[model samples]
Target: MEDDMLTCNSVESPGPPFLDNAASSVATSLRRCANDKLPVSDNRDTTVSRWRKHCPTPIENDNIFEIETHCKDPELCSTLACDIYKHLREAEAKKRPSPDFLETTQKDIDTSMRAVLIDWLVEVSISRKKVTEEYRLVPETLYLTVSYIDRYLSSKEINRDKLQLLGIACLLIAAKYEEICPPQVEELCYITDNTYIKDEVLRMEASILGCLMFEMTAPTEKCFLRRFLHAAQLCHEGPALHLEFLASYITELSLLEYSLLCHVPSLIAASSIFLANFILKPTKNPWNTTLSYHTQYKPSTLRDCVKVLHRLFRVGLGSNLPAIREKYSQHKYKFVAKKYCRPSIPADFFQDASS
Candidate 1:
C-alpha cells in the first residue's frame, strides 16, 4: 500500500503548535497572580509595573519541569481547566457558521442528493477504518471530514459529478489535519474505485483549502462531545458505555441532515447527550449542575435542538443511510445501534425542567 500511494507532502504546514503552551502560560500566570506573591513596584510608568498589575509574577523560571509541577496542583489545575474550556468555547463561537450559512445551498443539490453523497462517503470512511487494524483513524477525523465537505458545499456550487471528488478532497484535508499518517492520494482514489484521479484529488484539495481560507481548525461536534461526555460521566453512576454509544449515534445522525448544520457544534453535542440520557433512563433528569456548568446548556435550552435530533433519529430508522447504524451495531461499538429503541417520548420531554 505504501508503494502504491502518493503522499501529501505539499500540503502546507498547520503552523505553530503553541495552543497548549499558551493555555498553560495563562493558567500559571493567573495562579500566581491570585496568590498575590507577585512583586509590585512603585515605578508605575514601567512595563514591569503594567505587567505586575496583570500577570503580577515575573516568569523568571524557563524550566518546563517546574511549570508542569506547579500546574499539577488540583486547586490550581481547576483554574487551568476552566481556562481551557473558556478558550475552547470562544474559539467554537468564532468558528460557528453564520445563521444564513445554509442559504448558500447549491441550486443543483437538494436534500436527497446530499444524503446519497453522505451515505457513500460514510462507507468510504468505514473502508479507511478497516485498512489499518492498529492506529485506526479517530472518529473525530470523520466528523471533521464531513464538516469540511458541508462547509465547502454550502459556500460553492458544484455539479453532482464532482461531489465524490469534493468528498475525497475534504477527507484528505481532514486526515492531514487530524491523523498522524493520512492515507495517500492514491489510496483515497482507489477507495472511490478510481472515479477520481490523483491530480483531480490534489486540485480539489487546493480548491477546498482556498475556499475555507485554510482554516481547518474549526471546532467540531466530536470535540464538544468528548468534553460533555466527561462532564456527564462525573455525574452519572450507571455504566456509561451505553450512554456514550447512544450519544455518539445521535451525533452522527445529525451529520446527515443539512438543516442541522445551522446549529452550533456544542449545541448538537449537548443535545445528543441529553437525548441519549433520556433513552437510557427516561425517568431521571439528564442535565445536572456539573453538566450544565460545563456545557452551558440547561435542559430547557437544549429542548428545541433535542427535538430536532429526535426527529432525525426517528427518520433515520427507515432512511437509506445505514452506515452509521451498521457501524455501531457491531460488537466493538457495543452494538448500541442494534439496541436502539424508539420508545414513546413524553409529551413534555422538551419542556423546561424548571417550569
Candidate 2:
C-alpha cells in the first residue's frame, strides 16, 4: 500500500539521438479558443504567485475550520492532511515545468504537436487496440506521464518523430511511479507498435530521470483532486459517486490542454469540482464555504479556470481527441462525459463568496 507515488526504479543509459540538445521556442500553432491563454503570465507562473489568488476571500460569515474528519481516518494518513498540502503548495512552485518552455527551451514542436501527442497518449492508454485491462494505466499515471513530458520539453528540445518516443517513455516512467504492477518496457514498445525497441525506451527513461533528477513525485491536479474530492463529500448529500467521476473526467480533459499551464494544479482541480457540482446540481451553488476553506480559493479566483473548463464541457468532445470522452462515456465511469453543462452558468454563481 504505497502512496500512489512511492514507486519507480531507473537505469543508467544514454537516450536516443532524438532528444537532440537543440533549442526551438514556439507558442500555440493551433489555439482552441480565443480566450485560450497559452503563455504562463510571469505573475501567475508558480503555485506561489504566493497563491495570492488562491487565498480564501471573506465569505458571508462563518468560521472556517480545519478538515478534522478526514484526519480521523488512519487510512487517509490523517496526520499529513494539512502538512502534505502545505508542502505540495510550496513544492508546486519549485517543480512546475518552465512556464515558457515553448518560448525558451523548446523550439522544435508547437502547441499543436503537443496537443496531438497528449491526445494520442490518452487514446492509446485506453484504446482496445493499444492496451489491455492488465496494462491499463491509472489516471494518476497518465497525469504524471504528461508532467514528465512537459518538464522534459521545458529543459530539452525534441524533433517531431522523437516526440512520440518521449511520450511512451514518460508513460512507462509514470506507470512505474503510480501503478502497483506497471507495464513492462517490452509491452510499452509493443504499444508503440514496436516503433521503439526496449533499449530505446530505457535510454529515454534514463534521460528523463536525469533531466529531472529522478523527482517524479511532484504534485499534480490528480493528486490535489484526491484530497479535494474528499472535501467535496462534505456536502449535505450522501456520497455522490457520480460527482467523483464527473470531476475526474473534467480534470483529465485538462491534460490535452497546453494553455492551462497558467493555472496551478490545485486551481485546476478546484475548477473541476466546481464544474462537476454545477453539472450534477445546477440549481444549487457549486462552490461553498467548505470547498473554499479546503481549496483556499474563493469563487472569484475560480472564475477564469472555471470558465475555461466550462467551455470545454460545453464544447463536449468536438476535437479529434475522443479517448477521454470515450473512456468516461463507458458504464464503469457512470457516463459522466456524456453528461454536459449548459453553455453558460449564472453570473451570480461567481458572486456569492468573493464579490
Candidate 3:
C-alpha cells in the first residue's frame, strides 16, 4: 500500500522544483494542459502516445494552447465557450512578424515600390482566369500569396529586377499551401511572361523558404474575419453576404497599404467587421459582448483601426488599382466594390455608431 501511494504521489507531482508548489496550483496547470476539461492521464505511456498523435510538437518560446475540439458552431466555439480564442491569441502572439521585418529604409525598395508590386501581383492573380485552363485561384490563395510576399520581402533585400520573380515564387508557395492542385511551375513562369526561367523561380522559392525559416502559417486577416463574421451572424440574422463582401473589400484594401502592416491580423479583422456593420445596419451597434469577448476588442478599441480602414477605402475609390475594383465589380460579387467604395462617409454616421 505504501509503494502504491508513493507511485501515485510521484504521478501527481508536476515534476520539477519550480512546479513543486501547492497542490491547487499544480492541479490548475494540469487542468490547463488538458484544456481544463479532463483529468490528467494517469498512464504515462498513454499520455505520451496521445500527445504524439494529436498535439503539435512544441516550439521554443511558443505559448502553445491545447484546443479541445474543432469549432463546428462558430458562435459558441469561437467565443468564450471553447479553446479556439485562446489558441488563436497564442498563435497570433507567437507568429506575428517583427516590427522591423522590412529593411527597405536601407535598401533600394520603398513602400511605394512595394505597393506597386502588390498591385501588379493582384492583376496577375486575377488574370489567371484567362491564363490557366482548369484552375481559378481562390481569395484565400491570393491573401496567402500576398502574405508570403510581404513576409519574404520584410526579411530579404532584393533588386527591383527580381521583384516579379519573387512575386511568382510567393504565389507558387501559397498555391501549394492553399490549393488542392496548384498550377505548374512552368505555368507560373509563363504567367510572368517568361521573364523568369523555371530554374530562377525554383531558386527564389528556396531563398524565400530559407528566409522565412519554413514558417508559412502566419495568421491572415481572413482567418480572424471568419470567426468574427460568425459572431456577427449570431446577432444579425439577416443576409450576411453583403456585409461579408464589404468586409472582404475592406480587408483587401488594407493589404495595399504598407503602413497598415504594423497592425495585427485580428485588429484588422475586427475593424473590418465593425465597419461593415456600421455601413450595413446604420442604426444598430456594430459591436457587442459576443464580438468583444471573441475578438478581444471593444468598440472603442476598434475605432482607430476602423478609421484607418475607412481612410484606405475612401482613397482606394480614386486609386489606380483596377484589378481589385474589376474583380468585385462582377455580378457574382454583387458589385460591392462599385457600390461601397466612395469618398464621402457621413460624419454623423461615425458619431452615431460610436454612441
- Pick by lDDT: which candidate is best? 2
> What tens digits encode model 1's per-residue C-alpha lDDT throughout 112-186?
666777777777667654256423467877888887887787678898889889988988898899888988898
Model 1 TM-score (2 dp): 0.74
Q: What residue runs in model 1 are displaced by over 4 Å at the alpha carbon? A: 1-79, 97-105, 129-135, 317-319, 340-342, 347-354
Candidate 3, residues 1-355, lDDT tens digits: the string is: 9999888888887575354458759788887888757666677446434544532332322222222233355445322433444566577766665545555422776767667777777776665643346457777787788888877776677888888888889989988998888889998887777898999999999999998889887678888887777767666656778878888878887887777777888899999988877767666667666566556676666767788887876667346666676777788777777664335444544342235
Ranking by lDDT: 2, 1, 3
lDDT scores in order: 0.73, 0.79, 0.71
Full ranking by TM-score: 2, 1, 3
Runs off by more than 4 Å, candidate 3: 1-81, 98-106, 127-134, 340-355
> Considering lDDT, which of the candidate structures 1 and 2 is the better prediction for this target?
2
Candidate 3, residue 337: Cα displacement in angstroms equals 1.3
What clash count does candidate 2 reach?
3
Q: What is the TM-score of each candidate against the true structure?
A: 0.74, 0.78, 0.72
The per-prediction CA RMSD against the true structure, in angstroms, equals 16.7, 21.1, 12.3
Highest-TM-score candidate: 2
